[model samples]
Target: MGVTIAIDCMGGDHGPAVTVPAALSFLRSHADANVILVGREEAIQPLLGTAQSEFGARLKLRPASEVVTMDDPPAIAMRTKKDSSMRVVMDLVKAGEANAAVSAGNTGALMAISRFVLKTLPGVDRPAIATVLPSMRGHTYVLDLGANVDCSAEHLLQFGVMGSSLVAAIEHKERPSVGLLNIGEEAIKGNDVVKEAADLLRASGLNFYGNVEGDDIYEGTVDVVVCDGFVGNVALKTSEGLAQMLGAMLKEEFSRSLLTKLMAAVALPVLKRFKQRVDHRLYNGAPLLGLRGVVLKSHGSADVLAFSTALARAAEAASNRLIERISERMASMNEVKA
Candidate 1:
């Protein structure tokens, strides 16, 4: 049997335009995978086109009466919009009808609905939005990207353990290095929260690499970077802004002179390759770790390729037994305490 993923068709800014074609493209790429598109039937059916006839059986639809807007408060949506697309998709994952659910919806709503629907693992205090940061050497997993803005030391430690487990499972690292995202490398550089978490992480006996500075994220010094949502969000946005600025600057440089344009012709391939390596959308999806089931949050502005990338990630997360690895790690931690 193939991997099954639940996709929220009405979640992004582009809505079905991005989601439907993305699903079809994924189906084209991975013949064994099944995509369950969740949204209004009328909105999604036409996107499938004539391919709908052959793939209709493989592509299932689960109707969602409403959509949670990007501006909607997460608490209110979770409480009131019980039949929303985010809710329905998460429900499918909780019930095991789907192996994973991917959405480009509001980050807050996605996190809240996922937590409310799937619940956290036994030992986990919260579910975090962990994202993968592409580095010069490889990718590093960063957690609490915007889930809980105010987190405790215990919460940070939990993020460390979860991130470590995830990176290990996905990257096949026997013991992935875990780093506390801090202001500086020294243990005393951060406030009380980071200091305490670093202590706890060291005590937990995992491969703690001490504190890693913000600049270290792209250097790929550690396999997992742990921080609270507030800090992680700032870092994520800053990096994204820088990427955009660099692209714009390169465009200006290429347009300046005829000689530069000739140079641009020679450099276009190299620049395109570098952009692909650093593109956030290329590495857009990451598991909402600590949930009982897999859930991937794609970029809100995700195009067709980004959507297809997320689909592949969802399939990999399921096939690799990510949840099982997390459970095993939790069990090991519990056994040590006992």
Candidate 2:
């Protein structure tokens, strides 16, 4: 009777090995949560193991005959893999059998299928991928994290509206500030598309913060950062790579000598807290906003802890009625335009 999430169990890099356990872990933490695992039963059943009995009716398996692989093209996957775990999970959400769908699969395929199946919310032209990131002030929500490569000025304006709604829904912030990502903080910066988008945002009844550079993301200068998919994807990947390199370098430096090793020992607890603060796994789920139903995309290479975080995010979005909030915001924007 509680919220049920349909999971694409065989979608990620580690497939059921990562997803099944993550779902079980999520179930343990959220007593009122239920999961419908969509994958090949033979492969997923083994992973469930003893947890099946322990979890009982809260867990169910819905067999998927095929899988959409990482290398699979979005168009081909959409056309051929109708019964794939990814599509099946989405189908559950469309049928009202599940409150949301979570998948650690091919991002392109997930976006395409979700858009096709669930359709877009009224007044929304396209769906954008929005995720939370650690920031100096606290956290920031950035959108279009690789959904549409070439977006129009109108699309960007919609991204601002949707992103603000998302932040307000999840962070409980009223009128969260929205920033248009650009090369420079000046209004004259960026191309024609961005300039037009900025003008629209300024007039669109949003808490428009004008412009923000790349550093503004980490600085938490704004609650939501909006940009096209190409730029957003590059920024997201660059930050992830930088985080990995920094963590590795710090580890190497701390273990370089006996003195440094002892220093590391003294700083162990502080280091752990620091790691927890910036851990990418803690921010695993990226919500595909503007969709009529809840659809969350996890990192393709996510591990158990990371995938569990995605499920938790999907549950939170479902509970908060994120899609409904976006719809209302879009309707209001349309009324303003009229």
| Cα lDDT, all candidates | 0.88, 0.93
Superposed by TM-score, candidate 2 places the C-alpha of residue 127 at a distance from the truth, in angstroms, of: 1.1
Model 1 reaches what TM-score against the true structure?
A: 0.95
Q: Clashes per prediction?
A: 0, 0
lDDT of 1 by residue, 199-234 (tens): 989988789999998988999999999999999999
Residue 276 in model 2: lDDT? 91
Best by lDDT: 2
